[model samples]
Target: MRITPKVSKAKAEPPLILAIDIGTSVVRTMVFDRLGRAIEGLESRRSHKIETRAQGTSEANPDLLLRLVWDCIDQTVAEG
Candidate 1:
């Protein structure tokens, strides 16, 4: 006599939660389901760095940072 093994499959659903982190040097994004399990993620580094020359000096390019943020978001969304 021969016996067959049974297999089970789980249902699939769309992701529920999305997390994004935008830092001065790096940007990262992640997607998670209702259970908080990560499904997709992406990270990218800034092309340019913001530096201060003096104790009171401060500088940053908002346009560049915005571009990097969009790039990271696009990549992460594409991975999904």
Candidate 2:
């Protein structure tokens, strides 16, 4: 998977925060300002699938999730 970050030229005023969300099938990364507002064009996202067994068991690969998180963070920072 490749991360295509949204590029923003305007710098975020100080006190920036990085937010990461790992959902059932998607991982997201965003940069927010002190006021809790997302910085424009500073976000990344990746989608993944979970394994579902016939016995009603759900499984997710930890290593894959970790890699997604890393990629999101790296892309967000690189864009910011």
Candidate 3:
């Protein structure tokens, strides 16, 4: 007797667009459907301390900010 492996099909998800914003102190992620409306109850934000300079310049680590943006995107997709 030969046994066959069963393959599960992937479920179709609604079209979504991820809008990301990187600010000096926060990174925000939001998901919208084709209708251009935010999916209810689905959003992500990452807030971190920024480096302040004597000249009133504020900045954040590039690598850290990129990772935070990715994190927010991932969370938004998962929740939406």
Q: Among these predicted structures, which one has the highest lDDT?
A: 2
Better of 1 and 3 by lDDT: 3
RMSD of each: 11.3, 5.7, 13.5
The residue pairs found clashing in candidate 2 are none
For 1-80, candidate 3 gives per-residue lDDT tens digits of 65423221222235766788887778998766655656655679999778999999987788898899889988977875
Per-prediction TM-score: 0.59, 0.84, 0.68
In candidate 2, what are the lDDT values of residues 1-80, reduced to their tens digit? Answer: 75534323365566888999999999999887766667887789999999999999999999999999999999999987
For model 1, state the Cα shift of residue 51 in Å: 2.1
- TM-score-sorted candidate list, best first: 2, 3, 1
| Models ranked on lDDT | 2, 3, 1
| Global lDDT of model 3 | 0.72
Candidate 1 residue runs with Cα over 4 Å from true position: 1-15, 40-48
- Of 1 and 2, which scores higher on TM-score? 2
Count of residue pairs whose backbone atoms collide, per candidate: 0, 0, 0
